[model samples]
Target chain A: DQQVKQNSPSLSVQEGRISILNCDYTNSMFDYFLWYKKYPAEGPTFLISISSIKDKNEDGRFTVFLNKSAKHLSLHIVPSQPGDSAVYFCAASEANAGNMLTFGGGTRLMVKP
Target chain B: AAGVIQSPRHLIKEKRETATLKCYPIPRHDTVYWYQQGPGQDPQFLISFYEKMQSDKGSIPDRFSAQQFSDYHSELNMSSLELGDSALYFCASSFGLQKGSSEKLFFGSGTQLSVL
Candidate 1:
């Protein structure tokens, strides 16, 4: 069973607009959530993360929101640019779970210029 | 900054054959992880090592095994390859084990393995 799920396979947004990607998880043990962006033929790069302790974390134009009660999380990019277009994966790990990450099926975002 | 490096970016094997994929973690990194991504699928954790010792494992087939060496590099060995074994294998790394922080995995470009 897929513990993490990114229901949206792809998303499209216009440049300078806000882009939001959503993810859900079934495992309640997961306490740490992360977002990674990947390009074709390249490895994923870490974008942002949020611990279960908080409801939100932001860095630059990237912001991650976590709702533990709903077992859902979302990544928001303000003023989205073409460079932000890529496959975004959401992952979760339990602090005591030895760092084994459970990944969601990625969401491919296209920011049209 | 140096990222995780994986060798033999691509490999092909026949059924029942064997293949070995390698990973070189960043300088000073002490943890290494292995993941497998099937076509149209998400990455699944296989195994991980911290300080050259097995720390965690998940969804790895019995035909597969992995180890971390003293230099902090890692290798995933797959035997008895089957057509289903074809996938993109990714290697990731972190600096060290601290406060149970296993997130923030820096991944390699991955090695695509094709089994015929």
Candidate 2:
């Protein structure tokens, strides 16, 4: 069963525009959520993360918003750049767990310059 | 700085053959993890090792096994490989066993295995 799901398979946006990727989860035990960006032939790199206690976390141009009641979260990139084009994955882990992250099917983001 | 490094970037094997993939965690990191990514799907966790001990095992079959050396390097071994085993395998590492902050995993490029 897919506990974490990213419904959008792909997204396209113009450079300098805002880009939003959404994710949903069914498990309530997951207390931490993170976003990762991966390029072709490369490993995924950590982008940002949020704890269950907080609703939003921002780092530079990337922001993650979480809604516990709805069991949803989103990653937003402002003024998207061409370099932002990559596959974005949403992952979650439960508190006290051994940091094993369950990931969602990635969303491919393409930024057109 | 060098992140997680996985060897044998690509591999090809026939059914029933054996393949071993290697990974070296970042210096000073102690935990290592293995994940398999299939086409059009998210990465699925395979197993995890910490301090040379197997801490968790995911929904993988017995044909798959892993070991961590004293130097924190890890090896994933697959015996009697099947066509369904063909996928990209990633090795990740974290500083500690903590859940949120100290446990951000850094992944290697991955090993692409094609079983014919």
Interface RMSD of candidate 1, in Å, is 1.8
Q: Write the per-residue lDDT of candidate 2 for residues B1-116, one digit (tens) a residue.
A: 98999989999999999999999999999999999998778999999999999988897789888999999999999999999999999999988787686237899999999999
Candidate 2 chain A least-lDDT 10 residues: A92-101
lDDT of 2: 0.93
Q: Candidate 2: lDDT of B14?
A: 100
Quantify all predictions' global Cα lDDT against the true fold.
0.93, 0.93
* Model 2 interface DockQ: 0.74
Share of real interface contacts recovered by each model? Answer: 0.64, 0.76
Candidate with top lDDT is: 2
RMSD of each: 1.0, 0.9
In angstroms, give how far residue B34 of model 1 lies from its true place.
Answer: 0.2
Q: Give per-residue lDDT, candidate 2, residue B99.
A: 64
